[model samples]
Target: MISTTVAAVVTRFAPSPTGQLHAGHAFSAIRAHDFARERGGRFLLRIEDIDPGRSRAVFVKGIEDDLRWLGLGWDGEVVHQSARFEAYRGALGALGSAGLLYPCFCTRADIAQAASAPHGPEGLFYPGTCRALDPAVRERRMESEPHAWRIAMDKAVEQTGRLHWHDEETGEVTADPLRFGDVVLARKDAPASYHLAVTVDDAWQRVTDVVRGADLFEATHIHRLLQALLGLPTPRYHHHPLLTDAGGERLAKRRGSESLANLRENGADPAALAEALRRGEMPAL
Candidate 1:
């Protein structure tokens, strides 16, 4: 169990090894690392390599190298999600036994083309099409078809009652997991979804503070709900502003943002870059 003493502050920086670390990643890491170090707290590093098809071993090494280049070191050995499949499976089993999980066979295209589906922060949310399937049919489908597992949002909310979480930026916020409809807990291609894995990992590691970009603010509602369901302690959150380009678009790997390695190769001083990031100075990328 995590030390709950008022002085025991624990934070983490978890990034997927799908690509090189960019300026935005550096900013978030700096914030998380500083928040912990400044307070004499423990800061951890977790590599979220749950997606087998996209995650690469070389990229993981690049992440470590980039963090070191930025002068942000973490406490303890690094935790990798790919190596914790059994733990994730156990979490899914717990939710399944509680009747909170149901098989979701809907593909991304199916959800996108559904005219009735409502839009949310992350685009069109699942419409709970498979939540009402007959137990016999669901069992039969589970036997032969690949399916993701989604939480029964309404049922889960009822079980947990009204839930809320403390955010460093927004203050106390009520958790409305239903906005996500029935969010996936486990994916067909991965052992667990981000929602499930993160909640479980934070609890198991006893993380007391969660520091990440503001883009994930809404996702916290679902996470708070999951914590309540799994009897996990809620961590205080600090959703810092995202780093954007000169054109006002958020820096992203998909957009081919300038990476830390590129900056290093270009002769950018790591210490100077870290200072600029701390001062909120925009990168020339």
Candidate 2:
């Protein structure tokens, strides 16, 4: 439940529970938590454990444990994306009923083989092959083949028209859903895609400001369009620079960036560590 504390600003630190919390996670979490705390507003922690196969309960516990060790206290009960499948289904149904989404049967190899496939921030986007299929053909294919749901960018644009969203770092940016080209709303592995779940959750939580890393800056364009389509309010975004290692490379779990658990176990002071990040100084673990 959203706190009726009447605080003017509300922010959140949402992390995927697929691995141990690292230094980069700490920086983003602390920045969001402090932004709310300093303004006498509410700070929220949301578990973005959308993928059931990869997300482990131990990792989820580790995330909360690390946040506690860092001295960050959120205002309300933590929210979990896994528990909100029905809500996501409802939103997906809403989009489908409005003819804004269509089923995509293309696999990774299928997408890669498509001619003239344009690339977006993530990589080669969907080429909308299945989108051009006749309704009978699409229905027939849906009967036997597993598929994902994708937004129809062109049709969606016609419905909503030109739109824009605000960003603190880059000022206002015009929304460009086409660049993403019919991004997935639901995949076979998860009930809801990151874009759909996040857009829905932010509005449900009444988050007024979004603070996170700059990597997801491009996704804001699609999120902005979803908000417009669903009639949800757009939150002010502040995409801060990603925390980097001593070599000036951004930290990542896939690349084996040192986890905060590893750092804390090595005798680093949590309070001091938080202060070090606030000072823009990378700590020597």
In model 1, residue pairs whose N, Cα or C atoms come closer than 3 Å (at least 3 residues apart or on different chains), thus clashing, are none
Q: Which candidate is the best by lDDT?
A: 1
TM per model? 0.96, 0.96
Candidate 1 off by > 4 Å: 1-7
Worst ten in a row by lDDT for model 1: 1-10
lDDT of each: 0.91, 0.90
TM-score of 1: 0.96
Worst 10 residues of 2 by lDDT: 1-10
Tens digits of lDDT, candidate 2, 135-207 = 9999999999999999998899889999999899999899988888889999877779999999999989989
Clashing pairs in 2: none
lDDT of 2: 0.90
> How many pairs collide in each candidate, listed in order?
0, 0
Model 2 CA deviation exceeding 4 Å by range: 1-7
